[model samples]
Target: MWLLETTTLKPQLFLGDSTPYYAILSHTWGSHDKLQNLAGYVKIIRCCAEAASCGFKYAWVDACCIDKTNSAELSERATECYVYLVDATDPSGFGNNRWFTRGWTLQELLAPCSVIFFDSDWNEIGTKASQAEFICHNYVAQRMSWATRRETAREEDLAYCLLGIFDISMPMVYGEGRKAFRQLQLEIMKESTDQSLFAFSYRLNIGIRPIVCHLLAESPSLFRECGTIQAPGDGPAPEYSTTNKGLRIELPLAHCIGGFYSAFLNLTRKVCNIREL
Candidate 1:
């Protein structure tokens, strides 16, 4: 593991299992800032100071810890860093923090055994365990909600950044555009039985109004197939494919109508009433 030397901000290598406790900075990277420059160094310095305050001698900041010019090093570091201190605090508090909306931040939020949230001013807000109820109920939906809204400098990064979330790894292929996201979904489906992975927007019409609705109604178990496959050692990889046609399901008209009503009713209670809509 490469750690930032707290004093000189130099990269130092340490054995993965033998490393000392360290703090990680998880924040959105601005398009214009160069990590070697003064503006970019500010966040790194602040994070290092924060780690020192917490009795940690080492810190890891993605901007400085990984050598972006070396693709191999970048890939290695991406999965190595797990614990994260997500900056989720804004003037409006944790609810409105932009970190929650990021595609890469989704993995940062879930994969870690523990995650601490800090506000814009670097004040302690809470931990992921403390916010269990909110995260459990809304985690997947929250990811879907902002998956389209978050921005990445490289389009392929939209999917590459999420490799750790599904515990899957692949070589970075730049210039794939939106195809990267499709490949990501295929990889996820091979390893996971979570139907919520397919809980993305789809077209539905109630009366004369066409509306966007989430497949499986944000339920992870609804569409999950009940079975398991035992692969032989050195067997072939699982077969999966993606098509331009959106995810489709075949069901009786009554069942489809009932699901729509149930989803609509659930939305009404949480967000708006039919009259308000």
Candidate 2:
């Protein structure tokens, strides 16, 4: 694990214990050469400066510090992450910041113990620790809804980046495409008995033919309308397990007209903005 020494007097490595407390940097990489750009170079310097001010002797900026060629480094964790909003100039413009739309940033935003936000010029904005009210209490479905608006370059990253957010880790087989998301849910099922995992449906506008989907959500985007769903009560769910054929479960579904059955997930919907817990 390589770390950037805060002092820019010269690029050098400082000896440290195996597990050193370090600050992480989260920012949007430009399509053009970010390493070659002057803004990008200054951003790294500013990050080290900010980290020094935070009393951290070491900092890890993903752009240049990470050795992408090494797969083992992908498993590393940080004490906190600093998010530099390159497109945001002030607090009011944050809602439209490009950082929020990035898929990789989703994990960066939720994974670390503390996340600090900074403006383009390195002005302090706020921290996510005190403001993250939803993560601790929100149900699986509702929490998954937060990533609907985010995107990744590779379709597989739509699920890969969410590894930390869900506290699940699996082998990263990039070319599998949408199967990665399903693999993520399967891994989540191992950690959680939350029945809301199955409470996903496609929300299409009128006149659009309903697209066929699997029992599990294909991507976080499918969890968009799931914002209103709530977790089930304390009642234990019927014994279930994942198999090659799919999830084998005993559900008490109600019979409906036209030979259809309705499976109430023991969930209630408020049908309004569910931003609050």
Strongest candidate by TM-score: 2
**Per-residue lDDT of model 2, residues 149-169, tens digit only:** 887889998887778778787
lDDT of each structure? Answer: 0.53, 0.76
Residues 182-268, candidate 1, lDDT per residue (tens digit)? 676666665643344544444334574446653333321221221111222343333333347754432223334435432211111
What stretches of model 1 exceed 4 Å from their correct place?
15-21, 30-39, 69-93, 137-148, 204-277
In model 1, which range of ten residues has the least summed lDDT?
268-277
How displaced is residue 192 in candidate 1, in Å?
Answer: 2.6
Report how far off residue 89 is in candidate 2 (Å). Answer: 1.8
**What lDDT is reached at residue 146 by model 2?**
73
